[model samples]
Target: MSDRWQEMTVFVRVADSGNLSRAARELNLSQPSVSRIIGALEARLGTTLLLRTTRSISLTEAGSLYLERARYLLAEMEEAEQAARGIDSLHGVVRLAMPVLYGTRAVIPALATFLPRHPELRVEIVMSDARQNLIADGVDIAIRLGVGLLDDSAFGARKLAFVERLVVAAPAYLLAFSAPDNPADLARHSCIVQHGLFGRESWRFTHDQTVTSVDVQAKLWINSAPGVLAAAVAGLGIALATRVMAGEELRTGQLIQLLQPYRLDPAEVYAVFPAGPRPSAKVRAVVDHLEVALNTPS
Candidate 1:
């Protein structure tokens, strides 16, 4: 009898990657082992699946037919595996990726309550704004805030909330210089631009369903949110910042909102994970617990 399940997995990986070397790397197996599996699968079927060349590999007619069925079978097997392990009680380490500000303010605080419930569970958080591959990085979950989540492959994501951005300036700065009324007016002001992970300096705004992108060069440039907030509060210049990061300052009158009619693009925060893998009890619990915690303001 053919080892159909194992063969299907190897087939699916090779087809998706379109290269033996990448499939082997992703599977954490040697190239020879991958080749052997493919050879066995072709032998059982008594036909050539992949047409190999010195420089590249191409799928034959048989390979194309096999790939579709193989993917479905592999997906079904993964679902079954998840269903079999659906119980809530679990124990293991969960690697997490989160933006720095949220990691410090929201995620860490929620973990304090969650950790008690799962005494055997451990969490290692990689706090960064840069995106990384969850599987390659060994991450169980990633707390992301931005537009790149939709484009990611092999990941499942759930939106937590909308993160709005606002342009603000300290009271002293506003008194010294006029605040911008609209996107175009920003050009006359000294803007403090934040160069985030995506190398974005331009801000997006929407008015009456019409979107406009404003590129305001900054007199002062900063990479971190905390530094930007400080600079705005110290009357350095007008800063565009996330509502969550600048909430305290805005409430206390340290900074005043600018351009009320035009609003910046809102980013959604999501808890992302590997799509095929069933989350362990620890990961599931943390995701559930934090959703409630972050949604509720303390």
Candidate 2:
């Protein structure tokens, strides 16, 4: 029974990774060893689970069905072990995909506490601002910050926190002109827009129970949050930045927070995981820890 489960686990890893050599490195087995295990498992089942060539590995129809069942069964086995041994049973690699700057500046530091408590587990962070398909990327959890998860029906999500954003500029830029005293002043300034996140070159602010929206005329539109902040630090233009992304820079005076008192509505942060079956204990623990880390006072 143990051998059967290990076979399923190996099959699942290979299917997820799409490369036997990559799966071999992840599983700490040689490439030939992983190939042999897959071959032996397929022979026992009397069907080919994968279509492999010199370039890539893909699941056959039988492999697709088997992959689903294998994931479900492995998740169940982990849960059963958890019920038997509590937190000590949580051992394995958990892959987390997150935005580049937010994950590095805000989320990663917080994991310092969570990791020591689970030394048996390993966490791998895949960082990108672009959205990732969790199952296709073999990610256990993805951290997202935005207005909403409108099209993500294939995943289950937990809200972590709402992060307030700020309008900021470098000391050098302010020296050239002057800091924006109000939202309307941003319209006259050169703004560094993050096109991917906000889409429209616009900024929103609130004051005295009233809301204000301003359109920005930006010569440069950056697709990355970090890229936008980098432009601001270089005095290229003013930027709308999240506190999470600019915390260190603001503290060091590389970037100065602008437009006092008024603030943009906080963006929503989420921990998204695949939709089927209860998440493994390690996944749940990591998500829970992120909620604490992000929401905790800095």
Candidate 3:
């Protein structure tokens, strides 16, 4: 990489990671080398980009403005390279964000198969339940599962599939405690509640065109879907989960789906990307693969 472009890359990584050492580790360079790159970039620009201390680093006003433009320039450069190589060349890194369980169980398996065909491509998966800032984080794509995409004009979304939340428990748990016939009967049984974007205390269900929100009490409150599934499998309680997430368990008869009469709202899975230039071949290839992998029947 050229000196100026290399400096911009280091500056962007530092800004994203918020720590010089961490960014240096990611860039596979020594701390002093990374620090010097940033120092040189600031000197060349005649402006301070970061306010740093022993504990943390924060962006200066100029840093914030420069970071935005730097990202655009870097993206354009990458696109130029890809265009010069030919549109069919898939030889770049694709940073993807997804929820923990779905990314592990669904996305990774698909990638395991898709990646071998293109040895030059690399996928970095960020597993988190919280929404990520794509541009700021340097993420190329995000596989999101929810009611819909957040109202952000900066992102363009393509619907992948519709996934429904199902109340399920292990067969052992169901055999020990009689399953609830109706939503209200859930009050007398143990319920595992997940506390995040979907409300924890209130579980919404629809029946006969009438929607009902049941206020559920729980001894166990979990934030991650995998943890909740684990707790349910250990016979702790009935947990609410997305069908896509619990597909294997449900198919193998490890977990029994319950309360079929009542249904929760189906959430749409989306491949969200930055609203800028057209996606490079690497990004488009992975997005297309994920769309087919996620939507196709198992």
Candidate 4:
């Protein structure tokens, strides 16, 4: 059975590399040992899988079909091994990436309490509004705000929360400018615009089955969502912001919601990680903890 598994591994390597010598080098085995494994596999399967030549080796028709199944079986075995190990212990540094506002307003609270429970684990949170490549950036997990899942086949993305957006301005600002009665009124009002990773000025809203857009003429363009809120608080201009971020300000009357009848759909927040069979224990724990924290009533 051990030899059979070895043969399968060798067969997979050969199929992948397209040559026995290259596969042997990758597996740290001698050329003859690699060739013998393939020979044994072909004998067991009662078929020739490779066409060897002086210049190179190519897969036979049967080998081409078998290669895909072989890869799947190997991946499953690896996942089974990881799952067995996960039941015992989970300890590692988990690198996380997310937009600044969500990281500050939502994710931080969950991580603050979660980290204390697991002393052996370290969590690194990178707060940026930019969309980062998960694999290139070495991010174990990411939290993104949007309507649909990110189109990353290489990763697993799950919706974690819905965040409502609100147009808010200080009472003084509202009194000075007179709140906009409708979306069209925003054109006459000086608005504080947010220039996030997506862009500087486009915002969408819906009211009574009718969609309206305000092309905001900005007096101030800030790079961060929090910065835009701050501008609104200081009575600079009206700001469209997430309720998750502006909730305290609205409650305190520092900011009042404008165009209350026309509200934008809350941006969907997703917890994403590299797609795989068994998510790492550390990653799973963090995800579970975050859901609990975010869902709990404040």
Best by lDDT: 2
Q: How many clashing residue pairs, candidate 1?
A: 0
Clashing pairs in 1: none
Order of the predicted models by TM-score, top scorer first: 2, 3, 4, 1
Q: What is the lDDT of residue 108 in candidate 4?
A: 92
lDDT of each: 0.75, 0.84, 0.82, 0.76
RMSD of each: 5.8, 2.9, 3.2, 8.2
lDDT of 1: 0.75
Stretches of model 1 off by over 4 angstroms after superposition: 1-88, 133-136, 148-150, 197-199, 208-210, 274-278
Question: Cα lDDT for residue 234, model 1?
Answer: 98
TM-score of structure candidate 3: 0.84
Where in model 3 is the C-alpha error above 4 Å?
126-142, 146-159, 197-199, 270-281
- Quote the lDDT for 133 in model 1: 56
lDDT of 2 at 157: 81
lDDT of candidate model 4 versus the reference: 0.76
Candidate 3 structure quality by residue, lDDT tens digits, 133-243: 765566778887766445666666777778888999998898899998888878878889866645366778999999988877687888878888899888999888888
Q: Summarize candidate 2's per-residue lDDT along 1-298 as a digit string, tens digits.
A: 4768878988988887788887888889998988888988999999999999999889999999998889898988888888887885577889998888888888899999988888889999999887776765778788888765445776778889999888889999999978888899888888887765655676778999889999988878888888988999999988888888898899999999888789788788988886353678889999888898888997
What is the alpha-carbon RMSD of candidate 2 to the true structure? Answer: 2.9
- The digit string of per-residue lDDT tens for model 4 on 83-190 reads 886633445578788888778888897778878777777788888876665544556688877655466765677677777788889998877878889888888888
Query: How many angstroms is residue 3 displaced in model 2 relative to the true structure, after the best TM-score fit?
Result: 3.3
